[model samples]
Target chain A: MPIGFRAFALAGTLFAATLPAFSGTLDEVRKRGNLVCGVSMGLLGFSEQKPDGSWTGFDVDFCRALAAVIFDDPKKVTFQPLSALDRFDALKAGKIDILSRNSTWTLEREAGLGLLFAGVNFYDGQGFMIRRDNKAVSALELNRTRVCVQAGTTNAQGASEFFSTNSITAELKTFPDGPSTLRGFETGECDVMTADNSGLFAERLRLARASEAVILPDIVSKEPLGPVVRNDDVRWYTLVRWVNFALINAEELGVTSSNVTEAKRSTKPDVRRFVGVDGADLGPKLGVTADWAARAVAAVGNYGEIYDRNVGSKSRLGIPRGLNQLWTEGGILYAPPIR
Target chain B: MMVSAYPALLIRVGIPAILVLLLGGCGTTIDEGVVTPGALTERPATIRNEQLIGKWGVASYRDEKDRKRVEAQARAQCRLPYIIAKGPSDGVMMHLADDAKLYELRIKGGSDGKTYLGPEAPPGEWQDREILSVTDREMIMRFVDPEVHGRYGTFIYVRCPG
Candidate 1:
């Protein structure tokens, strides 16, 4: 056999060897008694571990919602913080059942890797941050300015493309990582910092003079972030996807944690279906109890409540619900109906 | 055209009464809380209300394979036609997402030059469904709300042969 053919054969063997068995992940999660969720190492508002060894943030709450659906207990889950390089590998190896990290859903990631994104949980994009003192309102005004971005990330490429396309002549400065990049921006080494808009909000809070920094309104790239599950198990995938949709639909239907109980008594067909008073077969189709959505909503509240609690207007980050709001309100966040 | 003018007059007199009925009938208002009132458009609907009065075979699909299959399926559904009844006003009777009962929705013309079917609210509102294409034989429509669109997909309405 030729060298290329031999290499191909070897690669095929390795791929088959690494391929997980077709065992249903939902069964495994139930048998294990806890859902092992993969999250970011330490990105505030998205995911971060407190000194008390408890995890909390937007991503963490999503996992908790999953737990609520399955076990009827929001705390019946383990948070495994994974680095960007290892997150997919960890998921593929079956170390984690679900990755609720703020991972962007892309064509390459879905097709190249044998994983699937459940659904877009957050609509994010590349953005710039500047000091309020500079008084620059838009990224179009950043010509001749110095921009600091982390090396070997999509943000750097996004910033490059945006500036070139718009004919803005700005100096591009690269740092080793997020901390160093923020340090560069803080120490006057760069005039503006670029990252995912969510990261910009999270990082701005880290600044000593956080109130002095402002994230611009311009979005340079689409970064739709969602939960990830391995493609081998359709049942588990459907469960996760519906959990997300349930949260979003609950918000749309005005079923909050405070009023989900009252909503159970609602005569409206949609509300009745959502709270499991009607369409009892819907949850069974997903291999769960009839009132799965209700349990999840009663535990974590709806998507809006979870968002506000973690990263939106009620949080310390105070990130406005620009694209995260319900499609009815003004944003693109939409979910499929339960029925 | 005179038939269309009569319904327009009825709409002017009938819509507020229907709104009041909807508001009063439901103990728990599902859609009223979140929908922010906006300026209603003045653009005339491209498709007239009279055009949708007959029966249609309706089916929806999310993927291409399903689209081809559902087009034929929609045509077959003409055996038990989905009636598009004339409303009490200048609208047609239709169902919104998860609606137990049909509603009298207006054929609103948007500033973007698209025709929409929804309640007498803003065009492209959550309850609205955009009319993608329409002809004497068939019509295609989809929900403006992403959630509804994700679930129900695009609907094809094939006109039932007389």
Candidate 2:
């Protein structure tokens, strides 16, 4: 066979193999040489740009975890900052390999749109906030309160449901994005600003005084956030999904980036299998080398490490591992068996 | 001639004291007598004077100034487990199920799809006995009591969706 004929044959085979995933992210990503992941524009603990332009956050860590499984180096990932409205379209167009922002898992987003959620990275809900000066103890007390929310998010719809459900009528103020919504809240232009609990903490750090605002106790909706990829990419989906599982499992196994290499020497079978030390070869099962899990573990430790480092009790964001804790630890962090 | 461990000693002692002084007010005041990881665990979460967390910047409310505003910046300042999915006695819950961990009243961002730290009220010597309620977007709490200043005060917050 001539070299030209051989090259042509290879290209034809590649195309045929990916016919189902054509115009999808699986092919484009492999061709591009890097996995492009969509992240929040700048939410501090979930996905935010460091002053040096590097990305950091729980969501960012998930992206790196996915990259590690693919390229054997988590840093192979290229982060793309996407706004709340643009994240979905970017993934739909194959502009990004995955959407790992703190986006909620909703029925409309899952089925209505051409997207699929891998797993819930964070379990959050919606609530209200007000000034301490106001004696408004509850969302029920606001007879004529003005609410500020994002225009296209579930927050918009949830706000409508909350007020109507409680028979409380008030003004609804929608904004273009998170920053403007926060600014409006700061300037006293809106009474309540609504979004994810994680975003609220990051936004609050920008305030002149951290005491003026108060969150209310009314979780009107559920926001189970996770990574999203275009539909019909089982290879990419399994790779991404398992990488997340690895993180959560790592956390459960107590293997952190700072100490996983040392801990890999453990004699425990589960530990050996998890860190690729034992005969367990789970990585090759996912289209990567058997050491894929090890590479991910080395690069980012486990889910607990990622959470604690990114949004857990020790980071600047310093959120506790509440519902995100492993099921063994009494939280809801269950994953499929590695076997 | 001025080279000495004396300067090093001063740096070692002075730096920490300054750090203590500056950060002292940021957290709850302590005895200034003992410190340890165990001690840190024993200390209760606290919110200090006028230093505010972000406001719940979602809805429209008429203020005394008659200013109609949306609450967007309501946020959390203290470390978590303040409002939790599990109980403090249980430490950190590993399962996503243990809502029994009432670390937060309800620190959530409401459906408008806003993400916020719902609400959390940790018990303290100078804290509120009842953390009233918690939601995903905001918190309603009261300190010890009107006489105690640690009761009957609520904190509402909203998290920005990243």
Candidate 3:
């Protein structure tokens, strides 16, 4: 062989040797007694720590939904609170069985990080909140301003792109996380702070006075935050993905947490089958009990039930269903049928 | 010629635009706490436009018919200051109000979390200088400043005068 061909052959051999070994995470999780779920440290509407230190939020419910399918008990799961920077790393390192944090699935994240997103649980966007007095009517007016953004998130990239797209430039200041980012904006260290819209809704609570702030009319990015797992675990990924599907299908079928028991008595064959009152070997398909979905619905709730109890308007978190609503109701929340 | 639904435009452009708004930055509270002035969190555990809290004639309005009809009837029976407890967060976000000085809208959710008042006095995200109009049934709020000139007209609020 010529010298160049020999060099190429050696490089290919080295590349093949560099690939990481794979393991069946799904199988391991089944063997383990409880499922480990990674949740956000705190993001009011989407994920929040209750006063008793129990994790409750839309994202947290997603983990419970997975647990319900795997063990027939939604409560049999652990919530691991993580900062934004640590969320991805924790999964890559196998610190959590599943990362159900409000993490966006972006191109760079999918290709760069050695992880896989099960699916989108929430569709969110990013926007600006300015002190009304700044007279900062639009982002175009925000030239030469300092912006506070979270490090290791799409927000920083968004800030850079928004300014550049508008032909305006901003001096960037980064905080390791959201709380610090809000603090930086408050102390005048930066003129603006940026994050997901849902997070912005939550951070607004900590402000000295609520009226001093205003969210601009424009939004900048598509953040499909969802469940994540290590790429090596295909089985575990299926379990999680299917659980989410069950929740979505439950809502589509009009089965709610409050009415789950009634649904058990439902004469509707599809529903009876879903609630585990009647069905084929659906649980066998996922290595779970037949009533796994029913147990989850009983323990936590369906997707809509989870939303109402945690981030719903009545909850302290107060998130609107928005794009998270079911497809039947004209929102985008469509999931494939579990059966 | 009327354009078809902007599917391509929405996906290509509107998606990013909405996401940009959703990811917009931090804000100091306009109103927070149990007794803080301008604190949005401090507002009544519930909020209804005090004036339009009664059953009344429905005309050019913002609320959807089904919910609005129920709200109107509730006001008639409950006397002024009627309570239309927002629904759970799984469906349409029936907007209550988006004011010029105060945008007080209600969406379906399990609880009322923190809310931020836009920086301007007459509500809505956009700023206005020369617009002031209010009515028991419907009002028009507009801005005439060269920098901001837009009109949100015929807003309907039922009367619930105590």
Candidate 4:
């Protein structure tokens, strides 16, 4: 065989060898008496540690929703905070059952890493942030400027594509992680910083002089962040995917935590189906209790509630629900029917 | 539209008495703490244009985390003044000096017998707020859609008499 073919064959063998030696992650989670969730070390609104050392944010709520469905208790889960470099490793090595970190779902990550992205929870894109005093309205004006970016991230590729397409040549100051990258930009090591728009907003809060910087209007690349699970765990993958869809469907159907009990009594066919009051066996299909979706909603509320609380207009980030809103509301978020 | 019919039925039964009470032209005030007889239902109260036509300042805007950073930004921008003006139809228009476009909102009666200020577009397009109290000196509003915008809680606006 040719060299290229030999290399491909070897990679295929390695991939097959790395497939989970054990089946049914759900079973293991049950035996352990708690689900292990992997999350970011700290990113405000998405996932962050409170003063009391408790976890909170959009991503954190997702894990709680999963736990609610499985154990009927949102607190029956433990969070293992991991940095960007180790998050995937932790998930692949079985140290975590579900990775609810704000990881971008990409073809390489899903196919190459032998992992599956359940669904996009937060729709994001890359953007730039500069000093407010710069008075630059457009990103094109940043020619010959220095940009602070984290290495080993899509930010590096996105920045390169943006600068090249805009025909601007600037120095790229790279750091190992998010904190160092933000620090470099804060200390004047770079004129601008680039990251997912959501991340830039979160990191801005950590700046000593946060009021001095402004995120630009330009969004250059797509970043659909979601939960990731091991490949071939068909039952587990289906369960995770449906939990996300249930939350989204709850938002569309107006079945919030505060009114879920009332919603269960709704005469609407859609609401009844989602609330498990229409005699649908959705939970049985997913290997959970009959009121799985209802419990999840009661535990963490619906997708809209979670978003508003953690990242939307109601959150410290004040990030608008632009592309994250439901399709009926002019956004791309849509879920298949439960029926 | 189907859900709207319920509110219309409520209006026929409740508005006459409230309108009679407000004929004095002092503007109707609905204290959120006081539950009116009609408040047994969930219909919103109707607000008159006279109550909202004035200049106001931003007192605060809270988020889920209750951080005050964005509120401070809004406060600085309000220094230019926020104005509520009469618009075409029953809709009211607000123009924040810094914003380029006019925001059109409508006052509707809720089952709670409280007036709410919601966007002029279709329902669920944007979050609505109840006019908890509106006076010559101060006005308070609370988000009607708690599931979507409740983290902001009640927004307080003091009359900017300058």
Best by the TM-score measure = 1
* C-alpha-based local distance difference test score of model 1: 0.86
Position A246, candidate 4: lDDT? 94
Q: List the candidate numbers ranked by TM-score, top first.
A: 1, 4, 2, 3
> What is the Å distance of residue A76 in model 1 from its true position?
1.2
lDDT per residue (tens digit) for residues A263-287 in model 1: 9899899999998989999999999
Q: Give the TM-scores of the predictions, in the order they appear.
A: 0.63, 0.57, 0.55, 0.59
TM-score of chain B of each: 0.74, 0.25, 0.22, 0.52
- How many angstroms is residue A209 displaced in model 2 relative to the true structure, after the best TM-score fit? 1.1
lDDT of 2 by residue, B101-127 (tens): 333222222223222222232222222
Q: Enumerate the candidates' DockQ scores in order.
A: 0.01, 0.01, 0.02, 0.02
Which prediction has more favorable lDDT, 2 or 4?
A: 4
Poorest stretch of ten by lDDT in candidate 1 chain A: A1-10
Give the worst 10-residue stretch by lDDT in candidate 2 chain A. Answer: A1-10
> Which candidate model has the greater lDDT, 1 or 3?
1
Ten-residue stretch with the least lDDT total in model 4 chain A:
A1-10
**What is the DockQ score, from 0 to 1, of model 4?**
0.02
lDDT of 3: 0.63
Give each candidate's fraction of reference contacts reproduced: 0.00, 0.00, 0.00, 0.00
Cα lDDT tens digits, model 4, A212-253, are 889887778998999999785779999999999999999998
Residue A41 of model 3: what lDDT?
83
Evaluate model 3 with DockQ and give the value.
Answer: 0.02
Could you report the Cα RMSD, in angstroms, for every candidate shown? 22.6, 23.8, 20.0, 20.2
